[model samples]
Target: MQSSSELFPVALMSAELRGDLTEDVYRLKPANSPDPSVELVLTRLGRFGQEGGRGVPVILLHGSFSNRRFWYSPRGLGLAPYLARAGFDPWIAEMRGHGLSPRNQQYRRNRVADYARYDLPAIAAFVREQSGQVPHWIGHSLGGTTLAAALGGHYLGEEDVASAALFGSQVSRNYWPLKVPPVEWGGRMLLKRFEVLSGSWLKRGPEDEPIGLALESLRWHGLFGRFGDAERDWWAGLAEVRMPVMAVAAAGDLQDPAWACRKLLEQVPEEHRHFLLLAKDEGFSDDFGHIEMLVSKAAEREVWPLVAHWLEHQRLPLTTAALEAVAL
Candidate 1:
């Protein structure tokens, strides 16, 4: 494994769409897009296993208010390289409004729900066109939630995805009562009022902060944390996903309680569903919060391997009876 500093140079080398990037990284425009065309800013590690062929493509989705850069950050608990080593082509997606995705200069009024309908579907279409198959969807936090919505038929075209691995995602509409500080609650109210006054044309903030810092700020004062009527309608659609799902929860993740995670897993129609919780010693204890499982150093060693192993297992051909037996 490379040191965090070593990884920083690689991450810095990747282009930021309009921003300047270091020498080691170069940006490439993805093929077969009808729109303005998406740019895949990536770092090519050596080929995965033997044969050196392009591996199974996997698209990673980051949590709320975070960009694709979270997957490559030094402290990031990303599984891209590890997946690549395990014979998978790792692709990180920046949702339409979040990362290096082109800003909507046209319809300026965009909301978090728009991501489920637009950005994620666009990414899925792009992946299918380029990779020739529906890639496995891996996401954390709000990213996972949006992906769930997309898989459940909220997105257009209804692509047949292979499977999904969701981390620290919530399925119920009961997230608001989770005991936030008074100041944070006040900040959230202010942001909600601001969004209403602005007609949902609120601009996104900078993207260089730590994942925790970004989500904390959103939790305190951004539309990302506010779940309204639209969000409730969105969650209602998650019951449509019928594919096998690997739902993960960290024992210490207060943002996604274990009970809630189990409840969410029960909603998956797949008999091959599995739920796993990160142990406290894995730094998933009280210190590592919601988004940390994807960006924290501890996740690289602990959480990611479990995700990779589960993905590998799902790729195997199993009869319905065998799968049900395993689920049992």
Candidate 2:
């Protein structure tokens, strides 16, 4: 394989349209990345009828073991499509070894650290190169976690981002089991035996996740461990992020509870920060699960529009503290 240094940053691979929306897929090969075989797939979605003009860019990052389809399906029925129709240019990114992006030479060794440090920056630069504007970012679950890592680590800054929104994303939630040194070491040892976790076997999602991700998580939750690698402390770096930010959590989501999500949001200075808890107690029709919070029919009526509004205004329609208390 040629060193990434020898190749251009991005190459347009294919283009198509879902109904009136145009889909142009590209492969991003970052020069700074350690492995030249790491190819990240990015799809730019054009507006419903405007194929010639580009709108403001919004990049959507899917969760663990997921791909672009998490945001937009083939039938043109998801947030990516909705954002496109709403006069926003949506860019769907598939991380290394997911969706249209093929597994690279170091696929089993891939971790969120690689994503935050290298992959995301390359994707953002490519989008800026094509769109000629800073792009807003939205991420769900692990995707959101990776985005937080990038922001908190200072890999992404105001120069690259118009705004950011995180869905079902948090790191404050503790795994008590991993806090025990023996258990953490044992789990890491067991996970190291596999190259990837089978999503279908686990009945979690469609795509498989690298064992490296699980190992990294174990280290983070191990005794005296924190949410960063040996290089930088991501949790501490979040204080340095000054961009507009929003975090959404589901009351019914046991994976990432609303309080932990709120804690992650609180790490940011309160100036342009927003938070939403999807629960009937909060006036929603039902308590939403982790994935259901964004993909459900109820979300279509209550949540998607709010996200669109946040993208346009860079904040949500938040009630005053007293009003929220009274409503509760």
Candidate 3:
């Protein structure tokens, strides 16, 4: 990996129109990090059919073992197009080694801390520079967790964010034996030996995850572990965040249960926050699981509209103090 001072500048790698939507992909190199070779790709989705109605900039982040396809499939259909048609400029980000972003020199050594501290800020800066506005960020699973970490650690500031929505993301879920020191330490040792975990082999998703991420998670959930790194405690920093935020959880998501998701939302001691649970018990047609909560046909018809509504309302003027005090 090159030194931070030797890192290259961000540039537009390519642009093409898929059907009626224009797709522009940008690459960003970290300005200051241990590994300057790490590059991130942001794919912008816009509706070419509508010329004059460019809406607010909204960035969508995919979870682990996934890429931009999580938001827009190869068929040119999904939430990215859905948002583009709705008037918003949607950018789908592919974290290092995922999708179009090529693997960095230290790819196998990547961690969530590296992502929150380096990649996200680079992505935010590039988006703000290009769009001339703080982008509203929406992330799922590990993606959402990284957003939360950036906010809490002040890696991404209020000036860099318009608002944020986290879908099916949480850090409070406990893995029973992993909480034991020996078990956690042993697990970390075992995971660190591998360069990457294949999603296809694991039957988890469409991409492979660096083993460093798995090691990072093990350290956080281990005995005496907390939702934080050596520098900051993200779990506690949530209360200091004042921006508008939304957390969505699925009832049938055993991977990250609704209770755990709500607990994460509760940590943010603020008024401009909303919690949504996709459960049949909550008047939905079915109990939605982790992936199904966002990618299903039901989500297209039911949930995506709510997401669009939130994005639209987030741009509105601040409400009264009294009204803002009421939790949604």
Best by lDDT: 2
C-alpha TM-scores of all predictions: 0.64, 0.94, 0.92
lDDT scores in order: 0.55, 0.86, 0.84
RMSD of each: 10.1, 3.5, 4.8
Candidate 1 C-alpha error for residue 64, in Å: 1.7
Candidate 1 per-residue lDDT over residues 91-172, each given as its tens digit:
7776544455544332234444455655566556555655677778788887777676665545633364677888888755
Error of 1 at 280 (Å): 4.0
- Model 1 residue 78 CA deviation in Å: 3.5
Error of 1 at 316 (Å): 12
* Model 3: residues with Cα > 4 Å off, grouped in runs: 1-8, 49-53, 315-328
Best candidate, TM-score: 2
Give the alpha carbon lDDT tens digit for every residue of 44-117 in model 2. Answer: 88965686677789999999978888888888888888788878899999988889999999889999999999
**Model 1 misplaced stretches (Cα beyond 4 Å):** 1-52, 74-77, 106-108, 154-159, 171-236, 270-272, 281-288, 315-328
Compared with the true structure, the alpha-carbon lDDT of candidate 2 equals: 0.86
- Provide the lowest-lDDT 10-residue window in model 3: 319-328
What ranges in model 2 sit over 4 Å off?
1-7, 320-328
Q: Rank candidates, lDDT, best first.
A: 2, 3, 1
